[model samples]
Target: MPANLPAEAKAKWLRVMEARTPQEKLEALKDFLSSVPKHKGTAKLRAQIRHKIAVLRREIEERKRKRGKRGPKFFIRKSGMAQAVLVGLTNSGKSTLLKYLTNANPSIAERPFETKLPIPGMLQYGDLSIQLVEAPALIEGASKGAMWGLQVLTLAKNADVIILVIDLSYDPLYQLKVIVSELSDAGILLSPKKFEVRVERRRGCGITILGLDPMECKKLGNLLNDLGISDVIVKVSGEASAEDVVNAILGYQHKPALVLATKYDVSRDNFNKLEGACRELRLKAYPFSPQIPRENLKRELCRAIMKALNLILVYVKTPGSTPIPVTLNEGSIVLDLIEKVLGNRILGEVKYVKVWSNRFKFNPQKLGLKSPLGDGDLVEIAI
Candidate 1:
């Protein structure tokens, strides 16, 4: 069941949604939490709201500390093909891995939590560049305002891929468990997703519902109405539970992740155990250590991230230019590539596309916009 918030709490939520800045949101969220009734039904909702408040407060205070003093950025912007964030317990070789992959040299100290802010480095694989970011180290309670835990989790939530760097010298499974639990509590899901919902507030799209019966939609609509959510499109999909729906309303994300077992040369037995556990848990794990060659590790890590993200590369040729690489989801068709290569306005103007791939023997195969593109395909568009 939903929170079934009272009118006062609902009004407070509206103000929270309307809030523009961190300080404004912090104040509004605090006020909203006060109005929420204390009960078993509202416990999870209150916890999520409190987490949001803590994150906002931290952001505000961080900005204040950085006021006019140019500091290393806390918020990292995305670049290159995709963003792959590195997260692990302190001193798990995240900084060393970043240093090996990219030119950005972060301090690689023996002490834990040496990397206070998010560090970014670029990994070049063939012709593609994937952005690799090392997040601040995580502690047990990082999700609930433990020394920049929420910030690190937020980074993971926004990233296209998550790299769980674990040390084989320690209990790899235990470290992995703590990191996954913290991420799960912060609404950043790494395991297989069982629920998905999208709620959008759009004008003229009045009370639209999908994937639910009329009565269920009506009940859900009434719940949203109580919270002043009108003219909204609520899309529900997958095997969702009541709690899943509530978490969706609270804004949760699913991420694709893999594990990199560091210091693997130290203990093969530990690595073997971790690998077996990863197989059972449906996660991919790789071995890493100082003994292993760094260059080969860089290439292997880059390709792994691409595959984990399920991304593909396609080449587009212009009239007077050479074919250039473009990235898209693995199963995207030619039209999807066209819309990206040429803007949506050009969709109607395309006459056809000529594609060349290893599957075809001829010089070029004539394909329509709907034609499926394979990896490393060269395409010429006619308009």
Candidate 2:
């Protein structure tokens, strides 16, 4: 659009406009960016061209990646109420914790790296079963592809909650910092906070958005224009940052995580330091030891992880049978429970539902489909 644009640059821009495939558009964009003159007046345009090239390149790369084979060897199927992965440095009693927490029988050893691969175990807590996995130890420079670090973290990232196990006998704070740093380097966010930005690229349609104010849209438009991303649907939920926009475009997973301090009986001084560090990092830490009653510790650990995951335990009761526990996301409603308990076919057959809660003295109370269900609520459905 600039009058001072060179003829060659304009010609390449025309080719980009005419290009159909992402690869072709990418090539034309690169050529245009290369041919364009670098001046203060054209700085903004140049940036836009570079951004477009990057976006196109990413699309092409993603397509190629999707063409590759997917396998079960690297990925574990999710099961149970929630999947929690145990991560820690070597000899942090991860295997011991696994054996105690769940039925897993991973070999416990004084040596490091005893558990070479991921071993999954099911932990039962208050009629709720959670799938817990013991992943390989994480060390420094893992993001650089050191010692199967990426593979281990990849599995951890897919989990519903990352149970970070740190040995209180050592420098627990520094170890926690290392794990957090490496995870950050791998583009895995451990915050419970969710980004308020969403992006969906559509072909032939220009940018359409919701949840973002006018100024936010204007700024986002400029960035998308730079990336040559014209056709997309972007929704922003909360106050998002520029980095969040780029991450949304790139597609990264933000997982909720909590700290599990092992060997509480090791050193009170170190345990105190670890607690202080966890507070500073805004992370919740739960201490556990083999000295405590096994059942109590298991229940405590499960309860802590459940709270961190923000889930609710719902009990479904039938007229002639015992109550069954059902896990649902926090803030779930009666309709959601119906869908979970009974299939869609059965959902239509339901006439009404009765709910009971602690507030209601566990007495049967009629609730509409839209009624919100709380943790430990009981529901009885009649068709």
Candidate 3:
């Protein structure tokens, strides 16, 4: 041991020693690599750490290939307006966040992998409730069924949102790499600058394209033909390239994701490192801490989730009462809200609605069923 090592380096080494899971240890090892002082005296120690990290990575990959079949224990039923899953390496404060955000009381411990199964919790934000499920720790090679990762990913595919719970107390950037790589391999993409391709198959009609050039459309059609698909209507949106077209044709969907940097108060330097890394990777990281008041954390999380999911809250009133809030997608119309709140019965009698949209430069206007609703719109139904 180096006698003149920095205090932060010593603390990271202690975290590595206290780590109880492979993924946690991997994160600690990375922290140690960054914290250690660079000098001739520590060259041998740095080399050893690098070698161990490489060896552990290989071992984790091997275990992934050797894992057996998974059964029904990993199922999660999503409730509320949207569902979000927390994915990260072990001991990333996922369980702690879960306890704070939802009604779930998962067994919290100082050890890694304390959560072996999927734990579901409900996070209520205003009139909207989101289902937040904490998945088992995801390690490298998780897409290949490493640590039953495929099972957890299966649940993620069904979720409307994916919230990555990163531990800023350690090497959150590296842990994020592991999580993103695994999710990508499983055909789950998380990008705020994401593109969407809509393919509508039409009988006996040649491929028609919208929002893309003719050449791009022809290329996409060829790709789809190779997959035995033909006669389709394809619409590309949001800066989609050739590669994005192919991915969509192959049943790929762009999923919205948010990053939550846990234990932000533990170390400012570590938090900064995480934020910079996420920015380079085109991800936005939100700060989270159990040490802070629970309400504050929840409000921040709700805002992030709403942004990721492209959702807005709509307040609807019967006539003489406080507006009842209902959550809906950003482009939702008045008819959609009526269907969600008042059901089909209201559709028969309601002709128009009076709305005050603070989002747009408009006064209280009477809108038809097809009129779009904005965030925080106060709506009144006229029978």
Candidate 4:
């Protein structure tokens, strides 16, 4: 018979997983195993926890051995763009969202966990293109590091922004709590006060939306107090027909957000219910039908996305080099890279090239010279 486990043991078990180093994790595991009373009720759980710890210890040893023989296990090269991750439960329209927003064509299925590997997509908003990465679904006990939960959490930690998608058809609040707990368990530390505001452009007008912004921090708490919302914010737009709203939010600066109600064609009342819920949460909700013709909606959404992101596309040319592709936001400096290459001492020696009438002229250099310049290239001015 297993013993009844105390609350302290469970808390200790959680803390053990939070250990940073392998040695610490081992120590935590040992402590937890020792602290847990062995009785009929808890014996089975203790065995399970013990098995997990043993597996973790073995994996750690293997990693250490490999590190001694080699260097690091994996190398992630940083691309020159801020990375945003789209996360949600399986079939929560994450893949669909990625497809509509970026060039990435991940498998969109009705099944769960369609995206096992991290899928990266380039989101072209106006002239700037941001990288959007979609991670796998997070399951229950994810906070406890169950079934690759730790891996997912690690990915989330590295992200500049985390876009958590949830199905409005289900309990949105419940889903939010699950994600928050998972993040907390993974040590991501998502504070409501730390939430930033994102401004999006919709229908040729700029719309400012509150995210986890400080101004809205209390709003979430208030909602919780009223039992109106759960731990997570659900946007009905994922199921809605308004792709523009979705694009606007994604391309929005400061990570602005709105709720999208999808599958409105199924039932009018469903859309209304979602809208009402959004109103209660003080969020904007739009009804959308996914079955609508693609051409009818894509352009508007793309435009909105581009506008919201404040993206700019610039062309660059370097001597004896193929045109390198680069996208930058408006008002960003191209001289930073040039300075790095030319060194600070020689900064004044190079002239800044100005773009006039959609044409850039090298200072004091004659125009109309036949040079192959492709789109999205950065050119340096050499006097």
Candidate 5:
């Protein structure tokens, strides 16, 4: 509704003008949402368009349901020990990287945006199979809802970690800028924060807080009550500020991420610049090429992902079955592993857990649910 709209906005408006159906209009509207500048004057218009988008989406879904088919779904289920998404600009060697790293074949071509959908593959690292998915390119203005941009970001949000594939042959910094900007606008934080905050609504809880000070809890509770959210449990880990808490309440994901600079052999000089810049951004950047030995590449990639995610692998033993590996965050407890592998019902029945680890003094240590677990720990839940 702003008078001085940009050319991009006008182009998107043209799409709206040409839209003949509700579905077409929905897509056009989404396009314009990206086109329109974010400012106080356009807030009302953006809100109205968002409302229309929601209604149209529902209608589309309802029609699909009537026909017994699925609607516009761009979701990929997580597989392997952990899920990591590889995202970057067009022709950034994402498909090529996936081909070399994982056990799935994705079309690699010279054209832009050749890979339309998200492709999933499994990376066999020693005894573990880590799922690595290649996501569609996230272009500039993606957060405002560029062409399938929201869907691309949805793929990123669903992943446990992110690997940004950048082309070393080009100005890798610029590619990183575009991708990082889009991710930031999508509310994805790359760097690991010292603290994490989570809130869950429990109707009768009256705002219980864990791992936080009593005084701060009262302050937070008062704020939540002011916002008509009094039945939520607020959980905090490590140190967090007021802004961090507010960002958490508004919804954000602090993804574990790294940058993989492809075509390193072609642009060896650029790789140093890219790595230096990434270091300044607190992001680790690695050089990759097809000529590198596969086993060494696989090993290095496995180690990098494990370090980036701060993960510890726990091998769970089941009777008459092979031990299953489970990836848990550093400092995860036995109870956390129990619920993940055995489900919630079994947690209450767990008498004690038997753990065998090289770090422990004894061969097998009998521990409780709250006992901390370590990497390569063999666990048996005796319920």
Candidate 6:
């Protein structure tokens, strides 16, 4: 009901109101609370902002309390492979990218938010396979736990590399800003120091994984700088092939990744413009059309995945009727673990698995597993 609010304050208020998630709304409220004038005419608006902040704060506290009782969550086991997360707005070709790269075959549709859960796939490079996790849409208010925003944040924080997929048809800069803002709100620090990596010699070869093309080299340099790599000199030697550049980037302790532009066939001009933009930003850009033959696209994606995440794949086989208890990285949700174990197997008779961790101490009497077998422990499986 307050009148005569400043334009800036009005904008902030509007953002708070339209915010998709509680965290975003909370941040907008804080801005409004600080920026809006508390004069006689604007008293009501000021009070409204304050009220919203209080409500958000309460909700956040409640969530924290609930999460606290649950204790620390499970994170993916860091196996020295660069973990890469494919992130973008809903339906921005992220799933398609995953499918092409790792043959993950996540549900791909023209509709938004088709990928509600995080899908992890591995791109095998000889003996190595990097883990690629496709995250859900990171809309505004993602920080304060809006629509699995917290889950997205958890996945990103655990990742060593992030592939931000943007629709070239839209304003690339705008999309970048949105992603940055969300990351910042989630308390992810972007510092130049994190970007610095010590370049090492491999097999007496001066490994430079930067693209050989002039435009690619320039774009790679810019992207490295944006990611906080300041001191390294990235030179594009026409002699170096795209594979060489990709290897160099992956081999570097601090690897800078390429921004893959999907739907390249839509418009050559748009692709060129995006490439120009990438060059301006000092980041490498690759044009890809998943609409092409699936096999070719899959190969391209596999190459990209290998470059993005320095992964080595090692397959372990377990032979037993008993369920092999896989100790996933701490902070892994039970749901994610279940998916990993089953892998497209329909959830039929086995509804769930009981996780025995330090945090979750099971009382033998409570679960009726108190009686010790001749061996270690006996668990009664319930369908």
lDDT of 4: 0.52
Could you tell me which residue pairs clash in candidate 5?
Answer: none
Question: Which one wins on lDDT?
Answer: 1
TM-score for candidate 6: 0.45
lDDT of 5 by residue, 166-202 (tens): 9999889899898888887677878877797776655
Cα misplacement distance, residue 212 of candidate 3 (Å): 3.2
Candidate 1 residues 1-383, lDDT tens each? 56667767866776776777778888998999999889877787788777787766765765577575686666789999989999999989999888877878999999888999999999887878989999999889987768777678778888889999998889998998998889887778775566578777666665687877666777777666544455667788876554455556755677888898887777767988888988876788999887778778877887777787778888998655799999888889988998898889988888778998997889689897777888789899877
Span of ten consecutive residues with least summed lDDT in model 3: 222-231
What C-alpha lDDT does candidate 5 achieve relative to the native structure?
A: 0.79
Cα lDDT tens digits, model 3, 1-383, are 33346657755765675577778888888997898778776776678677667645654664464365354467687688788999888898889899988999998888878999999999975676889999988888776656676667767777888888888878777888888877876667787536777767565676677887767766765654433344567788878766688666533557888889888888657877888888886778888886788888788888778888888998998678789888888899999999999898769898668998876577788888998998889999877
List clash counts for every candidate, in order.
0, 7, 0, 40, 0, 22
Compute the lDDT of residue 283 as modeled in candidate 3. Answer: 78
Write candidate 4's Cα lDDT for 1-383 as tens digits: 32444656655655563577777877887887887776665666567557657656655755566467764222123343456666667776777777866788999998777777677887764444557677788887765657655556656766655666666666655665677566654445332121232322233221223334444445433422221112233232222222222223222112322333444455546556656654664434444456755544444443333333444455544444554445445455545434434556765665544222234444323222223332344564444
TM-score of each: 0.77, 0.75, 0.71, 0.47, 0.67, 0.45
> Candidates ranked by TM-score, best first?
1, 2, 3, 5, 4, 6
Poorest 10 consecutive residues by lDDT, candidate 1: 222-231
Stronger candidate by TM-score (1 vs 6): 1
Each candidate: what lDDT? 0.80, 0.77, 0.77, 0.52, 0.79, 0.55
TM-score of 4: 0.47
Could you tell me how far off, in angstroms, the CA of residue 142 lies in candidate 1 after the best superposition? 2.6
Per the 3 Å backbone cut-off, how many clashing residue pairs does candidate 4 have? 40
